[model samples]
Target: MYLIEYLKSADSLTIQLSLTLLFVVVYIIVTKLTDRIIRRFGRKNEIALPRVVYTIKYFRFVLLVFILLLLGITWDISFEGLSVYFLSFFTVAGVGLFASWSILSNVTSAIILFFYFPYRIGDRIRIVDGDNSIEGIVFDLNMFSIVIKNEHGQKVTYPNNVALQKAIIMLK
Candidate 1:
């Protein structure tokens, strides 16, 4: 009832909706163009398609955020108010990060692993730290850790941050 009353009085809502639809159409067009460019370049060089697709998706997400911000402004949402909201959000995020330092470290390491790709599935790896060593075949690479299968057929999981920090010997 309140939403209907607000919409009925606001001519800006129609303008916001039109702008949002236009943004979506333009976004689709731009994405299609990007896909063609990626395909053309990727075909010439043997670039991985999944990585290219992920990059495109990230770009699209940023573009969508910008479009949404524009829509909000068109609807007369106050930028000053948004700044306070974002500041509060960042403060909360910072507190959460401080509370979960180990988890954050693991996530950072996983992101690095994704780009560096020191080890892949089926590769034999030995992780050494001081006197301890774990040897196994790489099974999977997840967001927080790496999974492996040892000679005894036991599954082992190592947090990415710790695993990447130590000496890793790739046998294959």
Candidate 2:
């Protein structure tokens, strides 16, 4: 049969190599599609928000990790080996990133706010924080903080971490 002939034409290693290459190609196509989806999302929101950029980068990183795991599987690597490798890597990274955990928290909040934040640029809003609450029109938002133009025309940069903790009232 033609199928039997084709299978006999290549060694097992060669067939596996071909399949691995195909997997990489598919991974690349999926990564590009995610990028396009992120772009379209940003455009639809009418702002190429900083969180969108971060999301795309994070999405690619996660996908790369997945494909690398698949590659390891293709090469007959054990799951336990992969788990040990990732665990050790993240452990070292965690030690180094400990001091800057607050920064990391803010970045995480920014990602959440990107999808669910009720206010947009030019929207007047108030943050409830006891007597010291601030009211302003959102001017800009970046990974770390959000800039707001206050009643006195002062541009206030509020940390994203705190933004999530407070109650936000959108004003007309």
Give the per-residue lDDT digits (tens) of candidate 2, residues 1-172: 9857877898879877977998899888999999899888777887655668887887888899888878887888887867898899989889878967878888888878776777788999998989978899999887888899999999998889999999989988
> For model 1, what is the C-alpha lDDT against the true structure?
0.76
List the candidate 1 regions with Cα displacement exceeding 4 Å.
Answer: 1-26, 29-76, 102-105
Whole-model lDDT per candidate: 0.76, 0.85
lDDT tens digits by residue: candidate 1, 16-133: 7867788779878987887687667545554445544544565577778887887777778888978998999989998998898778788667656655665677789999977767
Candidate 2 regions with alpha-carbon error over 4 angstroms: 1-12, 49-51, 77-89
C-alpha positional error of residue 113 in candidate 2 after TM-score superposition, expressed in Å: 1.8
lDDT of 2 at 157: 88
